[model samples]
Target: MSTIENLLPEELLETLRDRAPGYDEENSFFHRDLADLKKLGYLQMLVPTEFGGRGFTLAQASQAQRRLAQAAPATALGINMHHVILGMAYTLWLRGDQRLNWVFEEAMAGEIFAFGISEAGNDAVLFDSVSTARRVTEGYRISGTKIFTSLSPVWTRLMVHAQVEGEDTLVFGFLEREAEGITIKDDWDTLGMRASQSCTTILDEVPLNTERVATHTPLGPNPDPVVWGIFGTFELLLASVYTGIGERAVSLACEIVAKRRSHVKQAPYAHDPDIRWQIASAGILMDGVILQLEKLTADVDALGTDRDPNYGAQWFLHFSGVKGRATEAAKEAVELAVRTTGGAQYFRSSELQRLYRDVLAGLYHPSDNESLHAAYAKALLGPAS
Candidate 1:
């Protein structure tokens, strides 16, 4: 690990985890807890050291998000934006964009940088931006709607993607917190990760100065910027959430199981061998997910701040696979808890049942498992295979 990555003490992380809000069965309440993360510098870990910031590598930042995910998936989702924005802008900065210096400085001064991708009814909004940036005499005019925009409510600055000059080329732009006509719809009700406050955002004629935009052309369609690889940071972040979810599931399941009277109660699940098998199977899944994340993250960190020049299909495939594997494990482990708990799991007061519902919703964050499935299959059938 880099000296910088090692600087964040374990005790501090534990304290942050301890202070994180409990997983509320009601989604919106989880979202209200987002304010706590903003009070900390967790949102700006990516600013360069020259800017008086941590400038953590993708691996280090992913580890932090994943560690936190071990506690609150919802809270992790709320903050993953900072890591993504940092990694993205850090790459641009590496390519000699001095314009990003102020943004880095702002981050060092404790600004939350959010990525306005993932619109409502759309999954891969990063690749396809419905938001368009039209050139004006002064700068540009941006207008459109984005869904699941995390951490923007408390953000002082933002990193947004839109079509520049009404051209096919996609561009990244910065938006101020007090920008005119920037509205947020917090009606995001879902099964999990409710603390994200990932509401829909509407930009109606928001002015963006020329000095505030990045990515004059698409950095995708191959490997120059490794946009998909850049997206790997998010996948890893979600993987951390899964690891945390599994850890919490086991802890909660064991506590409840210990309370059940094995001999007195005529319980079907209490002593069934099948239940034992299910428990063992869930353990295997959790172990596999953790192993994969640890290995991948170690490799990412070893790569340091230099973004890879070539995009390996296998690495990309691994990234796509982890989210599906981890998400499925988290949901399955929680569902197993619900089943083992029996009919009582249905009661309004059942924590196992609440965990099941609340856990599954986070599966939808960033790249949905279903979309990654299709994308993975297409890659295999390509001529390169």
Candidate 2:
């Protein structure tokens, strides 16, 4: 099995890294990177082998994602939307559910999927949604606005969810990006991760034919495989990207320190005990983050969905903790890198500065620091009396 180091061509990563600054500077999408990834068959990496795809396991894909983030965090994050969709489908398929097999078949045929689950003030996560899926003559008419719709510029299909009006059902469906009444607002300007183009998507009575509806389950907690699949794949992959960013930051710090000479000591900064210590600390933290992510991913791929009934909740707790820790590690590593590199790294052009800004975004994803801690506490200590 090819390791993450060799999963993607080195030259491609170099090219993407070289172009990342320009894309960020102009707040443009990484169209070139996306096109290259498509040409390389990365878009269909999760499809089953029978469907002529690489059929990569979740562990393999997560490793590749971490590697990809080392070069370009925004690009890795944007492409993650597609991977999460395919990963979810693959997870379900492994559990003997063929309902989502068509997603793989479509992916192999060159369809790109985008995630459209986030909404304004929807803190219930997957259990509830503000969007309404009104019953229609043919299927359902979905009307809601979704935020953080990553890969908005190029996704061919949007996987979304909405509550059925006057019912206890939450419908999951895939709508074509070009379908009528679907408007994509190009308003994704942010503090970092600019190239992702995760714009706001407004669905105004978007129609979903009977054939397009994927799944319908009662709202709130349930024993649905799709829910577990989404939670497992999304959290792990998100953590992987931030972990990659952390890895890159530490390497850059080491490179910067190795070339500088301390005139007073008449020696390279690399020989300075303080600089060495800082780098060592960052490396140790990053290593822990990477190992945790790898082990969890391996477990998921190995166990599939046939484990104990409590596996889902326990797995989520683990994932939430890892995601929070990985993001924090990446942020700390980037901060240390800036300190090691001196004042010059504060410039807008500095890669470390970009990483610093990018790492802050981790605090905003699902299972935020507070939520993760709450969940962990609830899991271990039980809910407050």
lDDT of 2 by residue, 37-134 (tens): 88878888788888888878888898899889999999999999999999989888877788889999899889999999989998767778999999
Global Cα lDDT for candidate 1: 0.66
Q: Give one clash count per candidate, in the order shown.
A: 4, 0
Best by TM-score: 2
Which residue runs of candidate 2 sit more than 4 Å off their true CA positions?
A: 1-7, 304-312
Across 127-236, the per-residue lDDT of candidate 1 in tens digits comes to 66778888898788888897777764566666777777646777767888798989987777766566666777899988888888655657344343436435666677
Candidate 1 is scored at a TM of 0.81
Model 2 TM-score (2 dp):
0.96
What lDDT does the true structure give each of the candidates?
0.66, 0.87
